[model samples]
Target chain A: DARVTQTPRHKVTEMGQEVTMRCQPILGHNTVFWYRQTMMQGLELLAYFRNRAPLDDSGMPKDRFSAEMPDATLATLKIQPSEPRDSAVYFCASGPDRGTSPLHFGNGTRLTVT
Target chain B: QQQVKQSPQSLIVQKGGISIINCAYENTAFDYFPWYQQFPGKGPALLIAIRPDVSEKKEGRFTISFNKSAKQFSLHIMDSQPGDSATYFCAASGWAGGTSYGKLTFGQGTILTVHP
Candidate 1:
């Protein structure tokens, strides 16, 4: 099946540790997005990229959080010095730049900071 | 501000019963509305979607009811099965800032439990 793929499906780390989550968007898809899902806050968009260029990241914390698409098929979200409050499921989704295409998401990486 | 508001944080239904979730939006510019279903340990999947231009759309047992004037929409799962139990999120997307790239704003999801 053609779907977005994520790595490190689950992770557990102590506070102040660095965490990295990766995603592989479906081939030929031009737009990628990173989102954080939490029970209290619901789903929120962290960053969006088009053609490997970040169009908006206002929702992501600038100091410790960064999202990048090093190549067409790869996208990554990194957190340095993670905190317990940052524990949540991080999802990656991809879609076509044009048309009314709905996003196809990866299984997501569940991160727990203790 | 929360762009969209969802009702009934959760719902419990018996098998062969109908399940419904409602959502309302504040932005009239939102043209694309979609509902996503997520199971535990999985990412949300697109279940059904509707545009403001259409009042209602149905695909098999899933139906999307839209009310353009109220800026509200709802999803109805007919004859819900145990497998239908999941968390459902309603999302809206539209172009902004002179760019065609659309950003989705999601609602606080509703959890549904179907009892067999």
Candidate 2:
């Protein structure tokens, strides 16, 4: 399965610490999406990129959270001064075309902020 | 207007029974609807999809019924088995130039349990 690979499947950090999650999207995939999953909110789209250009990130908290795709193959999400409420599983997904296309998602990185 | 609301946060069904999940969207511009299935400890996978051109689409025991006028869609799983138990999500996206594809949105999700 030419799946999207996410690094640091699990991360544990304390409040006020910086946490970064990385994803390697499938080859030739042009669209990438970042999602956050938790029991209370369910699966929510945090941000997304079309052809490595950020399209919408209004769902994400701009104060501390940031998402970037440095290149076609690598996308990163970072949180500065992480808070306990930020604990959740973050998933990375990629699509061949527009958001209407089927998105292939990664296993997700479970973050635990104490 | 970009929200997709799903009903019955949880559901339970007996073996061989049918499980139905419904979703409604306020964005009429959404032309594509897709259903995703997710198990514990895994990312959601695309289960089935439907386009606005058709009212009903069926593949095996899974079916999607779309109502363009009502702006609603539903997923029906027939002859359900225990393996079919999982969280189901309904999503919608616009493929036309009028509405940007970035409008893709997913429903809250429904947890379905099938007892054998």
Residue A1 of model 1: what lDDT? 80
Q: Which TM-score values does chain B get in all models?
A: 0.94, 0.94
Clashing pairs in 2: none
Interface RMSD of each: 1.7, 2.4
State the interface C-alpha RMSD of candidate 2: 2.4
Error of 1 at B8 (Å): 1.2
Candidate 1 lDDT by residue in tens digits, A43-114? 999998999999889999899999999999899999997999999999999988785687888999999999
Candidate 1 Cα misplacement greater than 4 A, ranges: B98-102
Q: Give the candidate number with the greatest TM-score.
A: 1
Index of the highest-DockQ prediction: 1
Model 2 residue B12 lDDT score = 99
